[model samples]
Target: MNDELRERIEHEAEKHALLNAVKHDSEADVGAVVGPLMGENPDFREYGDEVPGVVAPVVERVNELDTEGREKRLEVVAPDQLTELESEDETDDRALPDLPNVDEDTDVRMRLAPNPNGPWHIGHARMPAVVGRYKERYDGWMLCRFDDTDPETKRPDLEAYDAILDAIDYLGFEPDEAVRASDRMETYYEHARALIDHGGAYTCSCPAAEFSDLKNNGEACPHRDKDAETTREEFEAMVDGEYAAGEMVLRVRTDIEHKNPALRDWVAFRMIDTPHPREEAGEYRCWPLLDFQSGIDDHLFGITHVIRGIDLQDSAKRQGFLYDYFDWEYPEVLHWGHVQIDAYDVKMSTSTIKALIETGDLDGWDDPRAPTIASLRRRGIRGGAITDAMANLGTSTSNVDLAMSSIYAANRDRIDDATDRAFLVRDGVEKAVINGPETGEPPVHPNHEERGVREIPVEGGVLVEPDDVPPNGQRAWLKGYGSVRHTRDAFEFTGDGIEVVREEDVPVIHWVPADSNHPLRLRTPDGDVEGHAEPGIASYDPDEMVQFERIGFARIDRQEDDRTVAYFAHP
Candidate 1:
């Protein structure tokens, strides 16, 4: 082959090798690599009679390059094109049910209203995924509404506002528009005034305890009889801070003898002395409650549907009263029961989790023990896996109590094919002296040979996990090497190659050159485990997932020189 032809072949071969490495494969088939290049550049296949000879040298050169280096080059060459390699045939079984009454002119809109009191946990994550699926199905809009009006009780945090957005984006759901309840205080006030003018709401000056007692006895507060003109003046006074924090509140008028006492004269707007973290501190004292604020925003934002937890049915009922007073149609409401994973001991309350984080009882939100989306992302769980799990749950209203095994199983299925395999020996290392070739190269991935190989300089000593070292005289197979017998302080070589010499279910243990392994500290749900990983691990970027030969999959959290920190994802 001419030098120019040789150079062209070698360059295309390098690109193909990089593509395989980027997918975490050991290698690509010669045809898989060559066909794409030929399709992209017809000149590469111009050599009619000498095609095999030209391709043979190019393949050899490609295989000789390091897998890690190829991955870096691939990132530079085609950053946007590199995606997870999942088989197309691996279809999701749970498809979204068809949305009702959606058509070309239908402006389908939904909102994920999260209280910005704390970071989003796993339970809170499903809402966005569920609504996002519908949004996709209808080609509609999603509004990320921050229900931050309960500043005194729930206490909105400035950082949590952005954190919620980040979590939603991490789940692969981007809102079409974002709104904050604190920003729309004037709009709520207008609605409150309108409600008062219609005699549907009244200002209650009775002490909270007294009102609770009267409401429990099916009696209205003394102020409930005041005319609209009087209530409007009291509401104006409330806006002007004439009353102390709990001395007065605007309550929506409802059936005094309603079966649910909570629905009787529910508080619509109240005074909070605590200043909001994000908004101008103490600029406005009167704040709208969730029911009033959501009820107003739903109409203003043109929301066509509302999907929330079944526990919030009372809130919907309370909001419906406001809708009736204004003669406004309420959006279609759907409630799903709570999902509980039995494996978690932590209550899925954002407030409780925030308190735990503050007291240092747990690590920050991304701690493996916490079920926040940040923690899952840090632990290397893919967004697709989370969406798939949510889809599988469907639109069931019945409460679900399941084990973590199903989630891990779903995650494993999505990630297994793309995760590169490496040797990681935990709980300290043991030396295995093998009597074999001085050097070896194992394919980086077992299924794909074109991905490349990892160099192993085997001058004798190989590092193996202490547990993998069998009892004296017992046989064990050194992965990528050969079968060996355990002797005192050393592994005596008993076989010639990787082929099995004895067939009594000998354990296949991964090993690395004793001096070449890097220190790896893995944080798991149970606790931390220390180990040594093959040096190739250093090449992985933070958040990249990799499988430990016999151990489970782990995502690299960070790397500092020779030490690497990883979070155990799943088995």
Candidate 2:
């Protein structure tokens, strides 16, 4: 082989070796890398017999590195593959990275915190799905905590609390404990007083703009050196409702010169006068910030592992000082990159959806067009599909746009078996089928025979989708029923068997009896699709998924007084 070819072969070999080793605990196998190597690099075909010899040494080189070392090098060599490897078909059989500092005897505890602002969008499911998986792996405790502290900016919705727990139950990862930060104000106040007495936090009365300037410049405020007694007195006053909104704040005593300016005496608590929707939560004028609230709760509730987003890495740094002051061990932290869903029309924000709903632009949280968990459940996207999709993505620390195709594929796998096949003719054109068969039996489920059949009553005329019509004098088959010859504005029954359409390569499409079918209005993400379906369509219970042959899958949304309605899922 030429020098260029030799270089290419060695480079490819090392790349595959690193990937394989990273996947299998820093241990690579020559056999695993060889097939992918030769298959992807067809130019090495002539020398395929010598490929194993080249890959064996590469495996040795890769196996010499530890797990982190191997993964670090892989990121440098091929970053995208690190994510793709996690999202591959191996998700069903692959294992996640081991939880740090964990053992068989360790008491494992986990938590998922939401603000209770609105229903969880698809992006919001990642953290709980990941933590829930870990909880199962170690038989740990899981807590669903509502971080509803920001009353002014992110006011808590009265209804989202139950909706979130419902989503968790649907995902099959219900937590052992459900809590709200707002309801635990006394606990937070007690901790704040203790921290103040310990000289770990102090009251800061600086104006908002001044604090921003000082924090940005890594300069400590004048109040940082106040005595603990003074700070405690001020904190008591604030808890006693002495300070108005934005008049003063409480900050942790971290290093002012920390390299990351965000860690410079970050706000631990603030005063918000906005009345909370919940009567119990509305009584408090003082609120703890997210970091301080979650930091204290993590230790108090015994949360051992924390699944966090990469954007919030600074939160860990900010909380580390408080842990130091209290002599507490921080929880095991895992930060994954963002999962930006592509090809989804809706913005993945709770506040945005709420605004749209208020403006009459959206129907509700469960609108078929929205991407909330409630919407997904209503649209027949199973909860298992969401969790399984997160498993396939894993915890790779590279922000990648999760393709819509993966979600569709996962949902398709979940619903394909239970879904019964039926016919839905869009923009139907009635045609007289001369001497047509009176009765036809199509399997309710194409893959399962014991499920029985859907009796499609064929009358003298059939309703066919306009798009399925063939040219004049062409043969067509009403799927599973019989063959018919197309005439001018009608069909002539030609044979009882399907062989003619199969042998002659004729068009075959789904059909419904013109006289016996019911009206259907399919509400898809795009818009409403009006059509006709077989009489058996009404037999399905609400929320049951059905496959309209050659069209797509849809969920039985409801039974309108005048028609049957379904939400289109996917093709």
Candidate 3:
């Protein structure tokens, strides 16, 4: 058993003991329960509720001691639970598809190939995690392959590639090897040549436009009847650039009468005139189709497992056919469904979004509305929270509607403990003058004394949110500390209040002073609005997510430049 897991079980026991004693209104030995595993296991956050009953008494005992005694005796585990403690260790470390008893002799390898069409989206981020998680669970390794084929569609952008690798690194996955399909063209050609030699494939003279009509009517190509030797010669000629782009294609001899016509004599190779990213630009009449290349790669790489989204499940079967023809061993295939993002009619394609950013129609990939990883980070979302959210969405064939608000809520929970309180002025109006030293500075956060507070100093003038500015003869509470009254062009408050602005008579929003220049802004869904708070407004640390009193949570985007400080308005 690993030391980490052993310590976690014992720690849970101690916590249980302390809580029980504390509930009884007695001094509990928190130290005894928390000390043993404190340094050993930094990973254990909160134990799941399904802890063993045997450990409950240990926690209760720890809680019964006085504070001084508790500190000395608060060992996580008693000496008695060693065997079960080891069992707990194994369980905690175990991952899903639970392959604990796999024979050590069996070698397992897998591959995760992502298409380099655009920046990897959140949906694709889960791909590497799933592969890596399963690989760790089964004690296997996985290859990271760049499926950069299709010269007409593939764009060679190092930035996108680096971003993908960075995201993979962020997810803690290291590929056993990295491969690009574009680099293996020669290998694909060898397989194509072998298929032609065996008479399983032949060159077709049918025009590209005729494919649909032929598939629909079960019409055979004119080149189908040519002898194997003659077809081979023509295929070689085609590869050597003897034919026009659409003059001929190499096709697998499949059942033309099959119910699904897509499988009927599908093209195994095609002629493309486009300049290749890796290969020298020449007349390339022989290009292995996607399904064909993937099949060959699986064999050469010895991929034992293939986990991809359900969208590609059929690709697995198509490649399986190629494997059977080539007498290659098939890998175990697992299909995860797509993440149907709830975007409220936003174009979900990464290409469109990228175009918008590049063309200056949108800010950048990190724009909060873009839904990229950088965007999520800028919005103060936690990586673990995204992982946890995806966990709730199991590997079922069904898709889940992941609302944007749900993601924000998860982020909010993660930063709740770490963030400080801030006051922001969204829409402001000057309140009645307090031209004296009677009003003191307001604290940054109420109730968090240890975090202490930054002062929002009171001057001759104070800015109140436009709604908070009451009409003549009304009272309004300033929330958290106190209340004040508003009269004709003046403001006053009494601890024993007579009359001015009554709380019921006036409803006002909260805002900081306009002239203090503490550097803050009210960020709305449309755009950011720059504003200022009272002088010496609380110091907001970078990336520190805080809730402005009554204005919602906003993270401090800048420290040095007051005008550049941006806020993410809470939805």
Candidate 4:
């Protein structure tokens, strides 16, 4: 890479890495520096360290998407593009409209209805955190409503639903109850029948091409004039499996001439030929549209508040119309913006990130790059860190794209007070010959006098970081620990001659004896690191988080045998 490109990548990586660090370390200094930048630069355009030549390829690739595909991508890539519809202009003669009142005393029951289409993504995790906060603050319940209306989307791997429930519980947001839309189909059918009987819905037999235009154009169809009795017959026939998939649909007789396109006649229910994972194929022919079903469900369940992403603002409006038509109370809604990490000028999505995990382009979902909750947890990011990050961006209607360094810094500060310290050899190198005292012990942490330190068992031969050693006969000392001297051929071992390097160097890394009965293996950036147990230090428990003295924070992964142990790093 050219200097400019290399610098850009490094800068982006550092910005993202900083958030990971804060969440692990809880660094206040970082917050002081980046907190003010949150809303001041909502677009994050000024942070572009991109080279002039690098813009062409990105522009070219984005241009390849079709119009509808581009619109779909905008929700994730550029949510600011979304525009809300304006209500009719108020005239002086018109009566003032009454808005719904919300207050502390309001019984605000909110819900998060996520479709169990695939594994829960970062987006899914974000919903609960946002909604749960409101519920906790207002003493409300955030119902976990499973939007299983479209049976095709429901998978055989029901464990994904269980995982989300588990994740919600782990995050301390247990729902009051679980409700599946599939089980409530009878209620949806009742609403469809009501609409048909009221002459507000009709059966449309338009082909795909004609329906595509009808969906957006706000143009009436010939079928819209069908009598209520005939329409009701067709709908009941739909219920009784008279229509095939895509052959006929019950559409609401919304104002087709409305300027706001989504307000036009919308599909109320349709036939799905696919099998339901939870039921036999062809058992049910009619399925309610998402907006209609959600509207009815929310009203029936008495959802007093709806907290969701800004991208779904239109969904709230559609449901609002339904509330007006049915004369039901509408819920108060709060639309929070999306979290955008600095990714070298490209936006990221949970689906794309998940694909990277499955394809081995990245590690599992917990991989730091994936941005999933598991990834954040695996990175030693405390829950307080994420909460702090969200708080940094207070509830605002404005959109904000942030460099992740700030959040990482928050996490780092959280773990700093509790982290224990230890020495680590990133790459193996033997220590130089003993020059200071024959034996010495390094404190686990610099300022911690009472916590005590792990003793290093050193002898004539010891290992260290290879890069820390010098050529020829030179001296290196391990700070707090004993020293070592290097010679061309100072020692001999039973294996390859590679073991003959002198054990003395400048503060060479300490290591456990290779022949020790209890050996500890650690996962680091380079690979697994092997060590021996200290004489007095007790074996670490599975969840015990400790600093390897000079090394970083780590949690015990497993106790393989009585003598074998594994450790994984965080942050």
Q: Top TM-score: which candidate number?
A: 2
Q: What's the TM-score of each model vs. the native?
A: 0.81, 0.82, 0.72, 0.70
Which is superior by lDDT, 3 or 4? 3
lDDT, each prediction: 0.76, 0.81, 0.60, 0.57
Candidate 1 structure quality by residue, lDDT tens digits, 533-565: 878889999978887765568999899976999
Of candidates 4 and 2, the better by TM-score: 2
**How accurate locally is residue 47 in candidate 1, as Cα lDDT from 0 to 100?**
59
Off by more than 4 A, model 3: 1-109, 154-156, 225-232, 237-242, 277-286, 433-448, 470-475, 479-481, 489-491, 496-510, 521-525, 533-562, 567-571
Indicate whether candidate 3 or candidate 4 has the larger TM-score: 3
| lDDT value, residue 563 of candidate 2 | 82
Question: How many Å off is the CA of 530 in candidate 4?
Answer: 7.9
**Collision count for each candidate, in order:** 7, 0, 17, 54
Evaluated at residue 252, the lDDT of candidate 4 is: 80
Q: lDDT order of candidates, best first?
A: 2, 1, 3, 4
Write one digit per residue (lDDT tens) for candidate 4, span 1-571: 3666445533433332232222223222212223223323444334322221122222223334454554454445434423210122212112111113657577868898988665554445556766666676667777888787787644333555686777677555789888777778889999888767767678988876796687676667778888999888888899998889999998887678777777677788998887667653337769888888988988888988776678777787766656666777777777777765553221255457656767886666554455566655654556655654554554456665544554455655556566655544444544433334444466665445687866665554455545545454554444455334456633221121211222211223344432222446765433456765443334666665655533445665557755434344432
Clashing pairs in 1: 26-451, 26-452, 27-448, 27-449, 27-450, 27-451, 28-450
Candidate 2, RMSD to the unseen true structure? 12.1
